[model samples]
Target: MMWLAVGAGAALGAWLRWGLSVWLNPVSSWLPLGTWLANLGGGYLMGLAMGAVLAHPHWSAETRLFIMTGFLGGLTTFSTFSSEVLTHLLKGNWVAATGMILLHVCGSVMLTLLGFWQAQQWWGRA
Candidate 1:
């Protein structure tokens, strides 16, 4: 049952990720905007989901797994990010590679915190 839930979530997440790439990747050639947005958004969504799960402990583990491990695992394209970084390095564009790394890492951390805090505020009052 857990596996099924995760698989279903992953399928949907993967499709969504692909759509983001198709739609937004063309906007920039130097950096994959779609993948970047995916990571940032995934981080925020992850934090929100975790916050909700923590606030409502009665929820099943499957629900958490489906959202975080399954959906997020597929939505955030770390592999694609790595490849893009490698591509930059191979082309001797160290600045671009490092910039991308910093942006994704910092942005992810910040957005995750923001999302978690926002979710907490939404549920903490109760």
Candidate 2:
């Protein structure tokens, strides 16, 4: 059942990631905006799920696996992000490549923190 949970969550996450990429990627020429966005969003969601788990320790392990390992595993696009950076570097777009690496890393971290904080607040935790 754990495998099923992960597979189902992954399928949904992958579809969502694909939809986001198709919808937003073409609007930018600097880098893969969709990939970056997915990473950041997935980070936030992972944080939120983690915070929820922390607040409610009684929750089942499978729920955590589904949201954290399964959903986030599929949603985050580290490979795509890396590939986009490499493409930029190959094309001599150093600034864009650097900017993307910095932005995605920093942005995902910030959003994760924000999501955790928000979840904590929602759960009435100090």
Give the alpha carbon lDDT tens digit for every residue of 67-100 in model 2: 8888899999888899999999999999999999
Clashes of each: 0, 0
Q: After superposition, how far is residue 58 of candidate 1 from its true place, in Å?
A: 1.0
Give the alpha-carbon lDDT of every model: 0.88, 0.88
Off by over 4 Å in 1: none
- How far residue 72's Cα lies from its native spot in candidate 2, in Å, is 1.2
TM-scores of the models, in the order given: 0.95, 0.95
RMSD per model, one decimal: 1.4, 1.2
**What tens digits encode model 1's per-residue C-alpha lDDT throughout 1-126?**
999879988988888889998999899878789899999999999889878887898888788888888899889888898999999999999999999999888999899998889889988722
